[model samples]
Target chain A: MRLFRSTLTALALALPLAAPTLGLATSAHAAPYTIDNSHTSVLFKTTHLGVSPFWGRFNNVTGSFQYDAAKVDASKVQFEIDVNSVFTADKKRDDHLKSPDFFSAKQFPKITFESTSVKAGKAAGSLSVTGTLTVRGTKKTITVELAKTGEGKDPWGGERIGFEGSFVINRLDYGVSYMPEGLGKDVTIVVAVEGIKG
Target chain B: MDPILALAFGVVVPALVALAFVVVLRRPFARTARGGETDLPAPWAAGFGLAAAYGIGVGLLLGWPDLPPVDVTLVAPWAAGVAAFLGLIRDGRVRGAASGVLGLGLGVFMTGPIEDMTLRVGLIAGVTASMVALERGLARLSERLDPRGAALSQIVLVSGAALAVLFSDTASLAQATGGLAAGLGALFTLGLLWPRAAVLTRAAPAVAAILVTNLWGTTLFANGHPAVLAALTLAPLLVSFIPPLAASRRAILRIAVPAALIGIPIAAAGAFAGLRYFATEDASASEHATGPTDPTSPSAATPATPSGTPTTSGTPTTPGTSGYDPGYGY
Candidate 1:
C-alpha cells in the first residue's frame, strides 16, 4: 500500500508538468488581431511651401498585426495604405492630385507599407518597416518609425491595442523631386492605429 | 481677370489649339490617304498646315506680344503640346481626344504643391500613368474604328502632348510629358518599332521645343539675360543631330545647318548671361531667403510649439516641421 501511495504521488507531480506543456500548445494557437481601419487613423502635417502649416489624413488603411506582451519577440505587424483615399478637405486640389503629376493611380493602383521588424515598449527601441511604395509605376522601399501605444479591452469585451508612430521620407528619394527648390523634400507621416482581436 | 486665371488661360488656350490641330486636322487628313512608294504629299501638307494652325492659335490666344514678361502659367500648355505631339507622331494615328483630356487634367491637378514627398510622388506618378494609359487605350479604340490612319495621328498627338508636359518645368507638365516620352520611346525602341518609327519625326521637334522652353523658363525664372537663354536653348537641338549623322550624309547636313543657326545665338546668349549673373552684385532679395531645414537629420526634430499642444498631433511637432512655405497659400 505504501509503494502504491509513492507511485500515485509521483503521478500527481508529473501531471503539473504535463498540464503546462498542454497549456503552451493551446496558447500557441491564439488568434491574432487585425487593424480596424474604421477605428484607426494615419495623420500627417507639413508646411505648405515652407510657410503655413497644412495637415492631412489618410483613410481606408487595413492591416494585420500580432502582438503578445509576454513574448514581445513574437509580435508581427503588416499594413497597407490606399493611395487614392488621401484627403485634406480641399476637393479641387485633391481631385487634381488624384490625376497625374502625383499618384498616377492608373499605373500604380496601391501604395503599400509592410513592417520588417517590430519592437513593442515605451523604451526607445528602433523599429523598421520595409515596404514597396508604388507611385506612377515606380516602387521603392520606405522605412517608418513605429511604437506601441498600449493595449486594453473595449467596453464591448473585445481586446484592442493602439500604436502611434511617425517617420520622414524624401519625395525625391523615390523619384518625386519635381518641385521648386524652395519647397521641402522631407515628408512626415504620422500613424495612429488601433487593432481589435480577430 | 485675376492674374492667376489669366495666366491659366494663357496656358490652356495654346494647349487646346494643339489639341484641335491633332483631332480635327491630323486625323481627318491621314484617314483619306494611304502609304505608298511615293510619299503622300496631301496628308503631309495637311500635317504641316495643322502645325502652322497650332502656332498661330497659340500666338493669338496668348496675345503673345502682350503677355507678361514672367508668365509662369504658359509653361503648362507648352509642355502638354509637346507631349500630345509626341503621342500623335509615335502612334502614327490620332488617338481619340484622350491626350488633350489627359493633358488638361494633369495641368489642373499638378498646380498645387503638397509638402509630403510620398503623397506628392504618389500623386504625380498616379496621374501620369492614368493619362498615358487612357491615351493608349483610346488610340487602340480609334485604330479599331479607322485602322489605316489611326496609328499615325494617334501616336503623334499623344506622344507630342505627353513629351511636352513631361519635360516641362512645371511638375504636372513634366510628369505628363516625361511619362509619355518614356512610354512611347520604350514602345518604339523595343521590337515594336515598325509603325511607331514615324513618331520619332514628331519627337525631334518636341525635343527641340522642350530644350528651348526649359532653357527659356529657367532663364526667366532666374531673370537671366537673353543671351544665356538662347545658348541654353540651342544645346539640345545640337545634340539631337548626332544620331541622324550615322544614317545619311544628307540627313547630317539637313540637321546641322539649322542646328548651328539656332545654336550660335543660344550659346552666345547663355554664355553672356552666365557671365553677367555671376559677375553682377545685384542679387535679388528673394535669393537671400533661408531655405527649408533638412528633415533627414535626427537632431532636426520639429521644434515645440508655444501653444502647449504638440504642433503636429500624434506626431513630432517642431517649427519648420511642415517644411518651408512659399507664402502663396492664404
Candidate 2:
C-alpha cells in the first residue's frame, strides 16, 4: 500500500515539470510575427541597357514570419507584393514597368514569395532563406541573405523585430522578357522589413 | 503626368498650328468654285496637315521603346496625306476610297512594317480591299451626302475609338486617335468660322478611311477586338443613304440625319468598351477588398488609391506582344 502511494506522489510531482518543459520546447521553436507593411519596403535596381542602372520599389507589401532567435533553421517567412504598386518616382517609367512588357500587373496582380528552407548564412547572425518567388505566374527558387537588424519593445510595449537583406534575380528567368536588349536581364532586389508581434 | 495630358497637348498644339496655317493662307488662297474672292477652305492642305499631325505626333509616343522598326500606323497616314494632296490637283480625283487604299498599300510596302512577310502582306491586302470596296460603294452615292456631313461623321467615329483606347491603357494608340480628332476638329472649326472659306472635299471620307483602318489594324494588333473600329467605319457609310432633298429644308436635314446615324453607334461602342474595361480592371477587384485588413490574407495590403483612380503605375506598355513579329521564313 505504501509503495503504491509513493509512486503516485512521484508521478504527480513530475507532471508539473514535464508540462512546462513541453511548453518551453514549443516556445523555443518560433513565434509568429505580422509584417508591418507601413515600415517595410522592397527596392529593386536594374541596368537600363548596360549603360545605367535605375531603381524602383513596391509601395505596398504585407506578409508574416515565424521566427526564433535560437532556432533560426525552423523559421519561415512569406510575403505578398502588390504588383500594381510599383513606383519609380517617374510616372511614365512606372507605367512602362507595370505594362505587359515587364510585370503584366493585370494578368498577375501579385508577386509572392514563400520560404521553403533556411540555414545559417555566411555573415554572423545572418540567415540564408531559400524561397519560391512567383512573378507573372512563373516561379523560381531564389536565396536571399536575411540579416537580423534588431528587436526591441515599441512605445506601446509591443515586441518589434526587423530584417534587412538583398539578392539578385534575372527578370528573363521570371518571364519578363520585353525589350531584352534595351533592359539588362539581371535585376538586384533589396529588402527592409519590420515585424510587429501580434 | 497622365498620358491623357500628353495626348491632349499633342493634339492642342498641332491644331493651333494648323488653324494658324489656315488663317494665314486664307488671304492669299480663299476662293469659291463660283469664282468669288472669299476666305480659302483648303481641304487638301487641312487633310495633309491632319494626317501628318496624327502620324508624327502619335508615332513618337508609340515607338519610344520599340526601337527602329516600321509600324503600319506610322506609314498609313502619310499615304492618306498623299491622297489628300491629290485633292489639291484641281479635280485629279481618286474615285471613292481608291486614294486611301493606294496610299496605305504603298505605305505598307515602302515601310515593310512587320518582319512576317505573310502577315504583313495579308494585312495590307485585306485592309485595302475592305476599305476600297466600302468607300467605292459610298462614292457612287456622294451626290446626296455633303462633305461637311461626312467630315462631322468621321470625327464622331474616331472620337469613339479614342475613348475606348484610352480606357484600355493604350496611351500611344490613344494619342493617334487624339491627332485624328484634332484634324477633323480643325476642318469643322474652319467651316464654322468662315463658311464660304470652308473646303469640304469629296475625298474626305477616303482620306479619313486611312486613319480609321490604321486604327483598325492597330487596335486589332494590340487587342483582339476590332469592333470599335469596324463600328466607326460602318456608321459613316450608313449616313450616305440619307436621301437627297431639293427643298428649302435640305441643308439642315442633310447634315443632321447623317450625323445622328454615325454618332449613335459610335456612342454605343464607346460606352460598351468603357463598361467592359472597368468591369475587368484590377482596380475594381481591389475596391471590393474592403473588408477588414486581415493579417492572414496578404492581399489586404493593397492600397486604396489605385483602386479608386486610374493610376499611372499600372498602365500597360504600347502594343506589347501584339506587336511581336517572328522573322519571315523566306
Candidate that would win on lDDT: 2
What DockQ does each prediction reach against the true complex?
Answer: 0.03, 0.02
> Cα lDDT of all candidates, in order?
0.43, 0.61
Over B1-330, each residue of candidate 1 has an lDDT whose tens digit, in order, gives 233543333334434433333334433444354543222222222233223333443343232312221233234335435453454443433432344444444433342334467765664454444444434433332323222122233334334333333222234443333333333333232212333222333333333333334333332332334444333433333333334322334633542343343345444553454344332212111111222333334422324333534232223222222222223222
Candidate 1 residue A14 C-alpha distance from true site, Å:
12
Model 1 C-alpha lDDT per residue in residues A21-54, reported as the tens digit of each score: 6766334643488888766777766666677667
TM-score for predicted model 2 compared with the true structure? 0.50
lDDT of 2 by residue, A1-198 (tens): 999999999999998779756676545468889988767879998877678998888877889998877878888999999887787644335555665446756556689999999888889888899999998767899999999899999888889999999999988667665545556778889999999987
- Candidate 2 Cα outliers beyond 4 Å, as residue runs: A1-198, B2-8, B25-38, B55-69, B72-80, B89-122, B133-143, B196-198, B202-210, B244-253, B282-330
Give DockQ: model 1: 0.03
Candidate 1: where are CA atoms >4 Å away?
A1-31, A120-143, A180-183, B1-171, B174-330
Global CA lDDT computed for model 2: 0.61
